[model samples]
Target: MTVQDKLKQVAESLGVPFVFEDWTLANVEIDRTPLPAVVYVLPASGELDFKNGNIRDNQNGMLAFLDKVELNGNGQDNDSVVDRMKSLAMRFIVKLNETGYFELLGGVMKYQVAYNKLNAVTSGIVFDVTLKEVTGICERNL
Candidate 1:
């Protein structure tokens, strides 16, 4: 199965949709070494460098989705779940940036939302958001 399909599978099993409707990017550096500096290193600074950025689509409600996700060390209190989500969501952002798969690609997106509901014994959650275009110049994989 494709990567998107795998993500969907994970979400379905968890009773959520694999929706990355919004967008963001960060952690950029030039990599003359031919690999991202974050995961690898270069002898010289400019020889291999990198930088990070984001598209900021935020339609499926970036804030809300982030607010709902949970984290390991974060609080599990009634008021802390949102913070946990934000923290966990940031990890994806960091990973995307470190791998050089994300960067600003200017575009317009009003709102983008995706959701799955389970009304039987649990409540389905939804997120509202917009879209943002992102681009990349894959260093390791093209």
Candidate 2:
């Protein structure tokens, strides 16, 4: 499976919406009514460097953004959105740690507050992820 596919799988396993390939946000309909979503974006194209004979290292930089709309106009705190974002990000990290197939170099979860198209307050988290692909070595006997 591809790296994108694996990441999406991890997100789905945690019961969170996952988007990777084409139109990462197109799956949802964002009309006047706001919705919560977890979107994965590939900010830079992945780099494939030769590691050894017939082996290559694929490095991909990704960002996972958690979007939550504040429907209530009571000046609600962003605690809920922050919690959800942290939970999902933690799960992703755990999954990656368990699997030797990927490496989590380092990342930071940045809290953001912005206005949506409907002028609604949106609070979310953006996780900057640096991922490295795992290489497999095969032994052949003649």
Candidate 3:
């Protein structure tokens, strides 16, 4: 399967309310989407490497987990909300690592939590991923 297909599978396994691809299109509807969602964007173009007449594809992508932030009456973010998002992000990372389907090209497996504007105050984690594919596979052809 393709990287996008693998990512979609991972997203579905998380059981989020929504799973979207192509952030450009999904961003327009994020405000309307229900909370606790996952979105990923993978560029169509990738770097190609040739070795001994074999080609390798390196693709870069991003995945995010979004959720509405709970706010206190004082108009401040609730600590629990932030903690929940972090916990969820950790779970996602664990799942990603467990898949064993993606071969990371480079970079460490780290995510950042950021504030986002949605229907309400939102917080989420953005994860950077790189997938490597070597040509002349055996499984599918076989």
- Measured on C-alpha atoms, candidate 1 has an lDDT of 0.27
Q: Tell me, what's the RMSD of every candidate?
A: 16.4, 5.0, 4.2
| Candidate 2 global TM-score | 0.66
Q: Rate the local accuracy (lDDT) of all candidates.
A: 0.27, 0.54, 0.64
Write model 2 residue lDDT over 1-142, tens digit each, in one string. 5676777777667666665532334333323223454555654656664455434346445544455555763435566666666676667778766766676544554434333422335555555565666753322310
* Candidate topping TM-score: 3
> What TM-score would each prediction reach against the true structure?
0.29, 0.66, 0.67
Candidate 3 C-alpha lDDT tens digits along 4-90: 666667767887655555765766667777777776764655676566665556777776777777553223564455567667767
Between the candidate structures 1 and 3, which one is better when assessed by lDDT? 3
Residue 12 C-alpha lDDT in model 3 = 71
lDDT of 1 by residue, 1-142 (tens): 2223333343344443344221212112111111101111111111122335322221112322322222233233423544444343344334433443324212442322212111111111122222222332234442
Give the better candidate number (2 or 3) by TM-score: 3
lDDT, candidate 3, equals 0.64
Candidate 1 shows a clash count of 32
